[model samples]
Target: MDTNSKIKRLTILITCIILSTISYGQTSIKNINLKAGKYKVGFKHYTINDCTRTYRIHNDFNNQLIERPIPISIWYPSKIENNSSKQLTVLNYLEILKEEEEWNDLPNYFLLDWFPYLWNTPENKAHLSEKVTAFSNSYFLIGNFPVIVYAPSYQASSIENFALFEYLASNGFVIISSPSRGTETRWLEGGSSKDMETQSRDVEVLLKEINKYENIDVDRIALMGFSFGGLSNVITVMKNKNVSAIVSLDGTERYNYAILEKSPFFNLEKFSVPYIHFAQKEIPEEVLNSDKIPAELNYKFQLYDSLKYSEAYSFRFHDLSHSYFSSFGVLFANRDQRQDKSDDKIMVSYKLMSEHTLQFLNAVLKNEKNAKEYIENSPVKNGFSESLFSKKMKQAVTKEFDYKDFNDLALDQGYQNLIPLYKRTIAIHPNLELQEGMLNTLGLRLSFNPKKLEQGVNVFLLALYIYPKSANLYDSLAEGYFYNNDFENAISNYKKSLVLNPENQNAINRLKQLQE
Candidate 1:
């Protein structure tokens, strides 16, 4: 063959090879279509009748005997038909809102009218009741779904993050959340490991209580948390052998706390259950250090290895803020129309984080094959490079003109065709704002497609540049580097992560093993 012919043949060969490589790397994750519905369990409200208990006050006050009441609301899958319009936990709602406003430094006005879309009435009381009831009514049943025990943040009641509790409850999982004593006031002051241990014991007691009910698979239990709650879940899962898995959503890193004289690293070896740590982009560096985190948890399986069970799967969304991982954030953001999409970063973070959490839970708790496949092969599960985001964004923009016609066609195709159109719409939108529905679609695609990993990483890195002191970003970069076999780079990034978070055991151990 002539030189030009040979060159053409070689070009085609290289193109095919690259395309094949991309195809081999990609994995598909299915969208979890949770139908909206309402269901309630017949819970007999009863307070824990402990007549006298010694309580310690924070103001150097003496221990006093007091009666502590556990007002419980049990929500289980029931055959009762008249439970549709039941009002949400009103007393709990008011108390939680008051506490959240102070903890998050949010204004009272924003908290009063959280979801404007759901509000429509002259009587504010009725509107609030309807809004909450509607939320409670929308339940998604994952037939025989595993149990997830949620530990609340320090000095924060279980009801404080009702949005998250409601969402999880609606998504087919039975969530058991409780407010520990001293958990409703001065959160930061009471964020102690001892408090977390006590909360874990509370979970154990709650689980025993739940056994009295029907249809709960006690063996398949997972522990999860948000913020200080995340730290609590970690300690809980580590201490409790009954817990099959542990999940952390923007949890406090133990690194900063590890340096304290009363650190909670006593039983690191007892923690053998799988852990899924979903970090926000704005986590402080003080929480990412290796020395601060227990050394055992730093192994590749628990740190950088995504394929193994008894592993740690960590991800950091570049634009995700600390408060974005819970439903309370959505209500907070919707309160102000002038606020940009960036303000709802927590909502976006929750959507993505929830999908992964569900997947991880399925893999560990239910032993779902499809979920495991998605976790092993998906870009989100493995590691995406930082270069692919711009490419995907550009591709999305280029296809915008065709979106209108596609939507019109979809309208005639029984709305099923609109799913693709909706996916394209997300790609086409240039606002960089993350909508929950749109994010759910794109995130599923990103998780499954290895070709998109580079793009996802690129987008995340761009986000990191905007928020540099982010421990999550460093952790993500370290994961990407480990996947790419750039162990040195991964180690360096992990070290940087440690500088920001001195207690990240996973990062430290991974670095040590890789160095060895």
Candidate 2:
């Protein structure tokens, strides 16, 4: 060959090898394939009222309706109608997110210094969202699909769980998620517990709003939450009988358990729903010491132990943290924080979790015969191990604590008469997350009633007993007493509240009027 031709041949061979490597890398992410399901997916958003109550979520003790809107993101099976949406690349989501005002703080979470390295690696960057997303503004599929209403983790946006949500929606499920204002955990300051009610009520309002549209199988609804969202699932199921099942993704009810003096919304004796819990296995050498091990991990063991009910299953995945459960969580966190677990390994674990969640839904919602075994019988893979668990009963059971049962009591005997049940329920379960909210609602609801003024005073007194440190609760009590014409008692409560917090302006203002 001529010298020029020989040089060209060598260059061609090297170019082909580089292209082949890049192709292999692009084809898979981590070690798992996150390709979209058989059906095309559609996306939409709904801004709904917070709940059944006329009052919005952020209202203060005065019951003045402070309007806080809830923005919900929904995904569903879609037809092949073309529009403006192009098949997305992973980089596209990055660009879209950067332009979003709400997502401005997002890039800080993703270690930007490593972005160039990840960008250059075709395997990590190629065809990720391409395997997901759909035509913008596409209509929902004609037939009814089972619904999955999701609650995001602490301060987590609906977009954080986008990959998982898209997977379920494309697989013939209608999945929706809300920002769950007030209870975003970041908002849970001053040791306040009222946000638990706000979260459930927010979820309830979002579902009711979404169900007004077509293609939703309301009967097959399931509540799923990651981390603290798990506790949300627990509390929401108690109030709504329509929810068929619950999935907790390493749910952070453990953290809540650490701070709970007692539970007002939970009852071990009343445990009945079919549920599945995926727990990050306790760290090595921690043993079973409650003090030594993190309270969050220990609480899961507490819940699973005391919370034996029908068709409940628990699995433990070793070498995982609370963060790896979500794909976006992995992508956003500092890569160095992942303990050197490759993206592929993390992806594999996510696949297992998602598949098991699907199996759980099949077993409970669709009556699939072998779905239980598929989950409980799962063997250890990539440091994932299943904890031996037995179904609570041979068959699934109905809800144990019905909202109608409590509502009937509140409506029939008067709100004050319902106190015994709250006290008794908390007596049995100390992790009742919504105790404060429930009591506040009870006290304030009756306080405004002309016939129930004394009842309001009684309920407010009870709330004070439960939350002694809460200046707001004391302020609420004083207002209730003042309205009931019990000026002496009202003055006493105002003084007590001032002792706790001298700068309680509302209480201070009301106390001056009562004295005059």
Candidate 3:
């Protein structure tokens, strides 16, 4: 690029900064000029109730399920309330440490216990919660908007990443977040994996409720979790197909925990979607705590490599620690000599984190061609060198389902000629989980195109061949048959499904509908 091009790009960014400042009213927040978006933002809370789960750690024994109140916080585009609306109060570690359990009762044996010593005694953040561009419970903007469900790191508040949430919301996305609840960092007695599993389950319940909102487009949803929260997010999205993308910020480091005892299948097996993980530079082996590196990091590396059929991106920022991923990191910095990095440095990293995240999520969820180009073409951002970046497009070889290639054929020509392709693909890449994701996408696409009902049936039939005993596939095939107006085949497949798995009430109900 020429000097003129460089000058033009800088001018555009500077203009954006100035306009954002003008709209949001210049902030009193020091050392940061974080950019806002096109729309004024609004924030509100949704208190979720009727959650029944009995954890052994809550008491000594697991009993009947009890109601749990999970509070979900939301940020969205709204009519500007006034120029003076301050950003919400920020939550700090000390307050979180006092939430439910006594401070002494929390674990202290870990290496992290020493790190907390570096924090300046938590001060009241009210003075620090300066100007930002958002309203308090303003009327939401009309139209169905894309959604981002965020998960905070262990022991952190949902408000930990408020900067990112508000920014994404300002850019016209619905952002939802919830407290970690049972899995909170207040106590580590509840195993890391167990807490994550609890949070993961909470995410499912939260998304179900978020979908009920009138303005949210259920089809476009993404999951983002910072630090250990990323682990929870990866776990949730692997189970919930409704999530279309994921952004993990310095997320891979949490793989050090073995809550699931190294069994990747439960959390990693079906990772066939658009996922990007931004990480801090790797720690030197000499400086590593143990004599060896954690096994889980290697597992994640293997999984990233195996995400051959998905749009996978991984990058390591030149100089950043794990905490730099969220806004809280900046507030926590420079507390003591032991923590020498200044808040301004972390703020720089956090700003980029917020910016890149919005861009990446925009690329996948909104299908913006230029956003994808920006991600692929511009790997390194100015000042902060993106030390390492890699993107794996699904290899088009056989036995492995090439999602991009197969999706093209399915949409352009139809699923009629796709079975042979899948057969060869499955033969080469015989991962049941990946195959399941492909089939599910095919089923969803088929449902949208009612005229392609028979094609849907054929696709499900191919899946049945791959997973012959899967009751769910039979039911899906039955639905496809019914959609095509083939009542007889529909009933037959539903009966087959019921015979294989008697508990599928959905299949039973569909069967009754056909019979009646």
Top-scoring candidate (TM-score): 3
Error of 2 at 34 (Å): 3.0
Encode model 2's per-residue lDDT on 112-222: one tens digit a residue.
333322333343444444444644557778987889899876545565577777777777788888763454322443222455566666778766866786778888888
TM-score of 2: 0.59
- Rank candidates, TM-score, best first: 3, 2, 1
TM-score of predicted structure 1: 0.50
Instruction: Mark the regions of model 1 whose C-alpha exceeds 4 Å error after superposition.
Output: 1-46, 49-53, 56-64, 71-74, 83-92, 95-145, 183-190, 254-265, 282-309, 333-341, 380-516
Q: What TM-score do all the candidates reach, one by one?
A: 0.50, 0.59, 0.63
Superposition error at 152 for model 3 (Å): 1.4
Which candidate has the top score in lDDT?
3
Off by over 4 Å in 2: 1-31, 51-66, 83-85, 89-131, 183-186, 190-192, 258-263, 285-300, 336-340, 378-516
Question: Which of candidates 1 and 3 is the stronger one according to lDDT?
Answer: 3
What Cα-based lDDT does every candidate model obtain? 0.49, 0.60, 0.62
Off by over 4 Å in 3: 1-30, 55-66, 82-129, 183-191, 252-254, 257-269, 284-300, 333-340, 378-516
For residues 392-508, write the lDDT of model 3, one tens digit per residue: 333312334456656665667666766686667667666624367678667756854777776777677677776889888888777777777778988998899999999999998
How accurate locally is residue 383 in candidate 1, as Cα lDDT from 0 to 100?
A: 54
Q: Residue-wise lDDT of candidate 1 within 246-344, one digit each (tens)?
A: 887756542223412244543444556777666545323333231132322222222222123256556656555444455443333222211123433
lDDT score for candidate 3 against the true structure? 0.62
Clashing pairs in 3: 155-185, 399-424, 399-425, 399-428, 399-429, 400-425, 400-429
